[model samples]
Target chain A: SQKIEQNSEALNIQEGKTATLTCNYTNYSPAYLQWYRQDPGRGPVFLLLIRENEKEKRKERLKVTFDTTLKQSLFHITASQPADSATYLCAPGAHGNNRLAFGKGNQVVVIP
Target chain B: EPEVTQTPSHQVTQMGQEVILRCVPISNHLYFYWYRQILGQKVEFLVSFYNNEISEKSEIFDDQFSVERPDGSNFTLKIRSTKLEDSAMYFCASSEAVDYGYTFGSGTRLTVV
Candidate 1:
């Protein structure tokens, strides 16, 4: 079975510092991986997508890198702010399917 | 910007009663999906719909469950018999196309007492 694992613990960082989160999977290599941010009592919102063939993807302050060789992906928030605090989820898309298997997610807190 | 929306931000129902969770997808999106998150758990996919028909469903979605795009803009999930275990946050999502990131709604919190 495919299993995705994130830090599964809360991460605290001082504002203006870089925060890094990890996602690792076993048993399968997916076609694409996605990251989402979820706030308390609200539905998750899509943040970024990194494809297997791509080494890295970036959106303003967010940067994601996919290392298929390691079966892992790292999410980074640069110059982070308190507004960046939320639970981050990692979902892996089956090699050629739409079904997504998500990790337990990591809670990030950027202290102001 | 277009976003998905769900009804009854919160619902409390008695066990054994039926409940309908509704959603409205992005105007032009073809793929729609339903996912649930039990308290303190990861989100779980329940079903996916397209072309007014179900394309896929997970084991969690059993005979007691049904989905309908009853009109051009509305999509719904009907639970034939709500169980206490059915208590969870039900999220509705849609994607313009498959393989794209899905936009989810502020889920409906269903509590079966």
Candidate 2:
């Protein structure tokens, strides 16, 4: 069976430190991988997308790295603040499949 | 910015009662989808619609669940007989293409009593 796994334990970090999250998948080769940020009772907001051919993508303070060889992706938030605290989700999709396979998501809390 | 709109932010229905959830996807999007997330669980795909028909569906999308593009702009999901296990947050999403990121609606919280 195909599975996407993220760290279920909540990650606590001090403010101004870098926060890193990992996503690992098995039995699937997706054409693209995406990251989303979701708050309580709200739908996910798109953050960034990295294609199979691309190794890394950065937008402002957020950066994503994809390693197809390892079937894993890493999401990083630089200069993290309390405002960056939220649940982050990883979604991987195949070339023709319109639907995305999402992981359980990892929760991050930046403490002051 | 454009968004996918869902009706009835929250719905409380009796078990075995039929309920319809409505959504209005972004105007220019070509693909529509329905996803559900049980409290504290991962988002699960229900069905995907394109070109006036279902392009794909997950195992969770059973015969009791149906989706329809009633009009050019509106999409709907109907549950024939609601069950306690069916209570979840149903999200509607749309995208311009299969590979593009989807814009999701605020979601409707369905609580089956």
Candidate 3:
């Protein structure tokens, strides 16, 4: 079965530290991968997107890397603050259409 | 910034009843989508709409599920017979172009009883 996986455990990091999360997929290659920040009881907010051909993408304090060969994408939050605490979701899409397959998000808790 | 708006932030429906969820996507966005997330589960794509018809839909969008852009501004998802498994947070999202990041509505929590 096609699957996208993220570490189920919550990442506990200190303020000002860099928190990293990983997403791995199997059985298919995605044309692009996207990251989203979701607060409890709220919709997921767009964070960043990286294409299969691109090595990395950055936006403010966030960075994303896509490695098609490895079928993995890494998301990093730099200078993490308490406000950065939320669940991060990884969504990867195929070559056609607008459908996105999402992984169960990884939670990050930035301690003040 | 523009937003995708959804109505009735929360709803409780009787099992076997019909329900319609409404949404107003960003005015300029060309692609509209519906996604749902069960409690503690990943967000799942239900259907995508473009040019007044469904562009693509997941298997979860069965005979009981249907989508329509009834007018210029409103898009709706109608489930003919709601089931317990249908209870989830239904989100409406829109994107200006293909592959663009989607702007999602806060979501409607549909609870089936």
Candidate 4:
């Protein structure tokens, strides 16, 4: 069975600091990985998608690193603000596979 | 930016009753999907629809479940006999291609009482 894991504990970060989160998977090699931000009572909003061949991807103040060898991916939010607080989810899937397996997600709280 | 839209933000239903959740995917998108999230759990895939037929479905999508693109634009998920365990937030998503990032709808919160 494929499994995806993330930190169960919520990350409390000071505003303007960088917040980092990790997502680890087992028993699968996905061709692409996606990160999403989900606010309470709302559906997930797609943030970034990185392929296995890409070591790093950046968008504005967000950065994501994919290390297929370690079966891990790191997500970073630089200069975080209070509005940046939300639960972040990571989903990984194969090229032909239509469904994406999502992790439970890691919550981030940016304190002012 | 195109967005997938789902109707009936929340619905409370009795057990053993039938319920149909509806969605209107992006016009230009060819692939549509149904996913659900139970309370605090991960989003689970229910089924995928393309060209007016089901392409793939999960075990969770048993005989009790059925999907349809009735009028070419509206996609629907029908539960024959809803069970208490069927309560979850059902989301509709669409993508231009299988590998593309999907745009998800706000979701319909179904509560089987």
Candidate 5:
């Protein structure tokens, strides 16, 4: 069976600092991994997707690195702001499957 | 931007009753999916639909649950007999392709009393 593990502890960081979150998985070699941001009482919003062959992908202040060898991925938000405070989820999926295996998101709080 | 839409943001139903949750996926999306998040838990995949048929479903989607694309635009999930444990937030999502990112609806919070 496949399993995904994310930090259960909430990540608190000051404004303008960089926040990094970790996602570790086992028993599966997903073709790609995705990150999503979910606000309270709302559905998740897509953030970024990184493929297994890619080492890193960036969009504005967000950066994601995938390490297939370790079966882990790191999501980074630079110059974090209070608006960036939310629960972030990681999902890993196979190449042809429409379903995704999601992790228990890690809550991030950016204090101003 | 086109978005996936779900109706009845919250639903409270009695145990053993039937409930139908509705969703309208993005117009051009080819793949549709249903996922649920129990309170304080990770989102779990329920089922995936394409070409008017179910392509895959998880064990959590047992005989009690069924999905249908009754029309060209509307997709629905029907719970034949809701249980107290059926309380959760059900989300509908769609994507152009499996590899592409999905757009999820606001979700319908189901509470079985």
Candidate 6:
């Protein structure tokens, strides 16, 4: 079975610290991995996308890296602020159509 | 930029009853999709639509489920008979890129009693 795993425990870090979240999968080689930020009662918002061939992708303060050999993707938020507190989700593209498999997501808290 | 929009932000339906969820996708998007998230769970793909028909669908989208783009703007999901397990947030999304960049709507919360 294909599975995407993320830490279930909430992560708390001081404001201005870098926040790191991990996503790992098993059994399938994904073409690309994507990261999204979702707030309570809101839809998941698109953040960044990285292909398996690409080592890393960055957008403003957000950075994502994909290591297909290890079947893992790391998401980092630099100089994190309190407002950056939200659940981050990792979704990997499934072969064939445009379907994707998503991790349960990791909730992060940036304390100011 | 125009975003996807779903109607009746919240819906309550009786189990065994038929229900239809409606959505209006972004005008320029070529691909459409439906995904569901059970409370406290990851979003799961239900079906994908393109070129005026369904391109792909998951096992969760069984015979009881059907999708249609009745008009240029309106896309709908019809549940032949709603079940308790069908209760969840149904989200409509659109993607223009083959790489699968999607813009999602706020979602319609369906509660089956």
**Against the true structure, what is each candidate's TM-score?**
0.97, 0.98, 0.98, 0.98, 0.99, 0.97
Per-residue lDDT of model 1, residues A6-102, tens digit only:
9977999999999999999999778899999999889899999889899999999999999999999999999999999999999988653656667
Model 1, clash count? 0
Docking class of 3: high
Model 2 TM-score (2 dp): 0.98
| Model 1 lDDT tens row, B1-112 | 8989899899999999999999998999988999999999999999989888888899999999999999999999999999999999999999877778989999999999
**Distance (Å) between predicted and true CA of A22, model 4?**
0.4
Instruction: List ranges where model 1 is wrong by over 4 Å.
Output: none
C-alpha displacement of B45 in model 6, angstroms? 0.7
lDDT of 3 by residue, B1-113 (tens): 89899998999999999999999999999999999999988899999999888889999999999999988999999999999999999999998876888899999999999
Worst 10 residues of 5 chain B by lDDT: B93-102
Model 5, native contacts kept: 0.79
Comparison by TM-score, 1 against 2, better one: 2
Off by over 4 Å in 5: none
Q: After superposition, how far is residue B102 of candidate 1 from its true place, in Å?
A: 0.5
Write candidate 3's Cα lDDT for A3-109 as tens digits. Answer: 99999999999999999999999997788988999999999999998988899999999999999889999999999999999999999887766787789999999
lDDT (10s digit) by residue, model 5, range B1-113: 89999998999999999999999999999999999999999899999999999999999999999999998899999999999999999999999999889899999999999
Model 5: lDDT of residue A23: 97
Per-candidate DockQ values are 0.68, 0.87, 0.80, 0.77, 0.86, 0.66
Candidate 1 - CAPRI tier?
Answer: medium
Q: Each candidate's root-mean-square deviation in Å?
A: 0.9, 0.7, 0.9, 0.9, 0.6, 1.1
Query: Candidate 1 lDDT (Cα, whole model)?
Result: 0.92
DockQ, cand. 5: 0.86
Residue B87 in candidate 1 has what lDDT? Answer: 99
Q: What is the TM-score of chain A alone in each candidate?
A: 0.96, 0.99, 0.97, 0.99, 0.98, 0.96
Q: How well is each residue in A66-95 modelled by candidate 6, as lDDT tens digits?
A: 999899999999999999999999998855
TM-score of predicted structure 1: 0.97
Looking at model 2, what is the TM-score of chain A?
A: 0.99
Better of 1 and 2 by lDDT: 2
